[model samples]
Target: MNAFEEEREMMLRVQQADFVVVELTLYTDTHPEDAEALGQWREAIKEAAHVRRQYEKRYGPLSLLSVPTEQAIELGWRWNSTPWPWQR
Candidate 1:
C-alpha cells in the first residue's frame, strides 16, 4: 500500500475503535443498575483502555474521540495563548 492508503487505514481503525469505546462509555455513564451488563461492560472498558494505551504509546498524546490536536502558542510575556477553533 502507498502512504495515503496506509494513513487512511490507520484513521479508519482509530475511528472504529473510538466508536466502540464511545458505546461502552455511554453504558458506563449510566452504570447504576444491571449487574450482568455491568460485568460485561467492565470487560469492554478494560479492553478499550488497553487498546487506547497501546495506541497512545505508539502515537503521541491523544483523546478517545480522536479530536484534532489544538497546539499551544507560547510567548514569554503573553503568558497563555491557545489555538482557536478556526485555527484547528
Candidate 2:
C-alpha cells in the first residue's frame, strides 16, 4: 500500500484497539475476577500505545497531550506546522 493508505490503516488499528480496551474495561469492572478479560484489556492497551507511538513518530503527535515539551523543542515546534488528524 501507498504511504497514506498505510498510515490510515495504522490509525484504524489504533482506534480499534482503543475501543476494545474500553469495552473490556467496562466488562471487567462488573466481573472483576475475570482474569482473562483483564489480561486481554492490558494487551490491547499495550498494543494501542505501541501503534500510537509508531504513528506519532512518523506523522507527528496526534494532539498536544501526546507531545512532550522537551521533544517538541527538539523537533523545533514542528507540530504547529503539521496538519491536524482530520486534515490528514
Candidate 3:
C-alpha cells in the first residue's frame, strides 16, 4: 500500500484499540466487582498502548503525552503541522 493508505490503516487500528479501552473503562467503573471485566480492561489498556506505539513509530504522535522521537524533532514535527484525527 501507499503511504497514505498505510497511515490510515494504522490510525484506524489505534482508534479501535482506544475505543475498546474507553468502553472497558466505563464498564469496569459500573461493574467494579466484576473481576473478568477488570482484567479485560487492563488488557485493553495494554493493547491500546501497543497500537499507539506502532502508530507513533511511523507517524510521530497522536498527542503531546507521547515523547517525541529524535527523528521527529529533527524533522520539525509540531502538533500544528498536520491535521488532527477528527480534522482528517
TM-scores for the candidates = 0.45, 0.82, 0.83
Q: Candidate 1 lDDT, tens digit per residue, 1-88? A: 9755654455556566667767866876787586877776777667666655554444423542433322211212221333221122
Number of backbone clashes in candidate 3: 0
> Model 3, 39: alpha-carbon shift in Å?
0.7
* lDDT per residue as tens, model 2, 1-88: 9988988988898788889888998999999999999999889899888888888777767777787745566776565574766577
Query: Candidate 2 clashing pairs?
Result: none
Predictions: Cα RMSD each? 7.3, 2.1, 2.1
Which pairs clash in model 1?
none
Question: How many pairs of residues collide in model 1?
Answer: 0
On TM-score, the stronger of 2 and 3 is 3
lDDT (tens digit, per residue) of candidate 3 on 18-84: 9999999999999999999999999999999999998887767677787566546788776776575
